[model samples]
Target: MYSEEQKMYFSKNLLDWYQTHKRDLPWRRSKNPYYIWISEVMLQQTRVDTVIPYFHRFIDQFPTVEALATAPEENVLKAWEGLGYYSRARNLQSAVREVHERYDGVVPASKEDISALKGVGPYTSGAILSIAYNKPEPAVDGNVMRVLSRYFLIEEDIMKPSTRTIMEKLARELILDGTASDFNQALMELGAMVCTPRSPHCLTCPVMAHCSAREAGMEEALPIKKKAKPPRPELRAVALIEGTGEHAGKWLIRQRPQEGLLARMWELPHVEWATTAWQSDEDNQEALRAALAEQEQIGIQPEDWFMDTEHIFSHIVWKMKVYRAKLGDANRPSTGEEWIPFHYRWVGPEDLQNYAFPNVFVRIMREWQEGNEA
Candidate 1:
């Protein structure tokens, strides 16, 4: 536990600094709980600079809770195209639908109601309640934890749930009367701007004089974090299936299954390999042809290697090798013994924007487009 004088100094100095130095972000312009909710979700594991445009576009497209709740899932996914971790977008829509139906389109101020919504965790719930409703709840996130750890010299591993609970309790106690909104934001601001993960700007930090980590020369090492396991690698073979005749200047794509990873998102036809041992171009193409025939009942004749790329997720990294290919027998159903799957589609350059694609597929398509134009 920290002394009252130390807590008071930190609270007063941080609030004073924040009033004059806070960034003029778009979300800060209003206390609308919906805007606060959207910004908090967008800010998770994403930088402010990267989220600004997406936030603006998202708000313009779905200006109100009712508007977002009523929008189609496809349109919502399209709007959230580039922002990965699409589960956030999906959960947001599901929760907003609840708010529309149950709460009369108003974001719930009570912790129990908001926290029960999909993807509305403690940090997000606290943010919505305090920033939008001016409640005295603490919005403790990684930023706040880092700031607290260094200032108070708490040496617990931040990755642990217990440490987070302690940080939350301390954060709540720091909120002075009528200052919860600014105080929480100020803590987050200090962490982002001064008490950074690497070399902290101690001299510029308002609470530096009382920072226990700075006093002990451990500012960079106070908030310990356990390293996460590396993403497992998976080798995959992708087919850039080109179209001919009536379907000229187009490529084949398909939507993923209704469940699992990247659910319902469009992607180029591809198959995963069990091992990392990469094969020769000809062998890889043969494997792709055979795999496509076996998996989707589609026949293909690979022309040549197109490119190699990879897409990383939190748990897996897909190392993809793409090959240019054409339909083995477009006019007949005998080649692979069946019709094209219902989820497949042939899309030209202009049609690419009509479907929502994972960023890796988008990258591949862009590269193909650029090479063709050249």
Candidate 2:
């Protein structure tokens, strides 16, 4: 338990340090709740450097709440291409639409009103309320938890939900009147820069003088978190079907099913194998051919092998082997049989603008483009 004097010193010193050393982030420049919300969502489990370009482009494209609400979902997805975690984009748009319609394009400032939004959770609600509205709310995230645990020497497992509640209350107590915005951001900044996960530069940390973990020489081990289960790897075989005849300059692609993982995104045709350690390339290719023919009614004759790659999600990993192929079935829309009926399309490089893809697909396409250029 931290004393009143210690908490006050932590809050005052942190805010003062932040005022002098805070990074000049674009979202920090304005008090717009919408921009702040978008940035915070994008920042989760993502790096600051990676979010910078995406943030700039997203704000420029949408510009306002109404702009985002009115824009087509496809357009929004295209803008978010390669920024994995497609659900974030979908839920954000859904929530933004609510704000536009229900709140009259104004972000609700009250905790009850903002917290009720579609994707706004405790952390997000607190962040938006404090940073955007300057409310005395605490925005406790992984970074905040780490800093708090070290400063107060809290050894509770942060992975547990109850631990978050305790941290939130402690964080709220540390905020000075009218300084919640700077104070929260300061705590976040300190964790990111100095009180880092590994080899934390405690000497440069703003609240180091009163940091309990530092006093006990346990700064590196204060915030204890349980290890997560390893990702389950799935073996996948992909058909890099190239178009021929009038469709010579294009390649075959398919849109994923609408309600599952990586939903509503464009990707190459592939089939998941039953096991990670499959028999052989020949067996895998034959299985892919049979699966596509039976499942999609699309025929293909896989020829040579292409490059191999892998993509990782939170709980699953895809280890993929790409193969070159040409469409053997003339079931395409242009070839007679009805294709409205078809979820696949032959797309050229120029047509990539019309669709969004996961980062793995983007990497595959980039590699293909480079190969062609070379």
Candidate 3:
């Protein structure tokens, strides 16, 4: 813990450093609560460089809370297509709609009120209240945690609730008497630029002299962390089925179920690897044919289909073998399964921009496009 005078001095020195060295980010240029709220939510677990374009495009499309509230969920989801964590986008829309109806399209000014919104937690509420409304509240995120831990030489595991309690207490105690917003931003900026998670640049830190961790030669080890969980493995097989005749130019794309991972997103039909027995290519094809016949009651021959390719996720490795099959002369698929018409939408050489696909899908599309180009 710091003496009141030491806290004030540290806050002043950090703010001075920030005034001279802070990056001129787009979000920093405005005090509007809506814009600040949007930027804060988007920056969660996402880098500034990645969020910039998304921020601009999103703001342009929905300039105000009212605009966001009025926009269709599909259009909002489309705009947020490439960005992962689809739940954030959904929560954002829900919050905006609530604000429009309940708050008269005005974001709440108090921390309690702001925190009441869907997905808006203590940190987000503090950020909006202090940064946008100049309220005297501290926004204690990981960055703030690092700075506080180093300055106080705290040794608690940052993942633990007790550590968060201690950090928040210290943060509230250290906030400058009337400069809480600037003080919080300075701490965040200092952590991001100088008191980094890795080798901290203590020599350049404005409050290095006041940092107990630096003084004790434990700057790198002050903020203890919890061990991470092991990643789970999964496998999937995707089918790139094609249509014939007028629909010949299209391919089948189905919307994912509204629950579970990647909910409501469009994807090619797929089967879990565990659900099917692993077999040779010929055997696999026969198995797939039989499954389709039993499941969709499709009477299609397997010889007309050709293998496409595969993809993988963070925890899952997919050994997908895609099969391209041309439909018969019949307008209706012989299979009882719904044959949603998708044009071969040939994402030709440079024509892939017409499709808005997820990053994983985009990677696969690129590979297929490159093959076509070659």
TM-score of each: 0.97, 0.97, 0.85
* Top candidate when judged by lDDT against the true structure: 1
Model 2: colliding residue pairs? 339-342
Candidate 1 residue spans exceeding 4 A from truth: 334-339
How are the candidates ranked when ordered by TM-score, highest leading? Answer: 1, 2, 3
In model 1, what is the error at residue 358, expressed in angstroms? 0.6
Question: How many clashes would you count in candidate 3?
Answer: 8
lDDT (Cα, tens digit) per residue for candidate 1, span 231-298: 99999999998888777888899999998888898999999996678889999999999999988988
Going through the candidates in the order shown, the clash numbers are 0, 1, 8
lDDT of 2 by residue, 1-374 (tens): 56999998898889888888899999999999999999998998899999999999999999999999999999999998777888999999999999999999998999999899888899999999999999999999999999999999999999999999999999999988898888889989999988899999987878889999999999988799999999999999999888778778678899999899988889999999877586677877889999988888888888878889999999999999998888875455665652422678888889998988887876777787789889
Candidate 1, poorest ten consecutive residues by summed lDDT = 330-339
- Residues forming the 10-long window of minimal summed lDDT in candidate 3: 340-349
Residue pairs in candidate 1 whose N, alpha carbon or C atoms collide under 3 angstroms: none
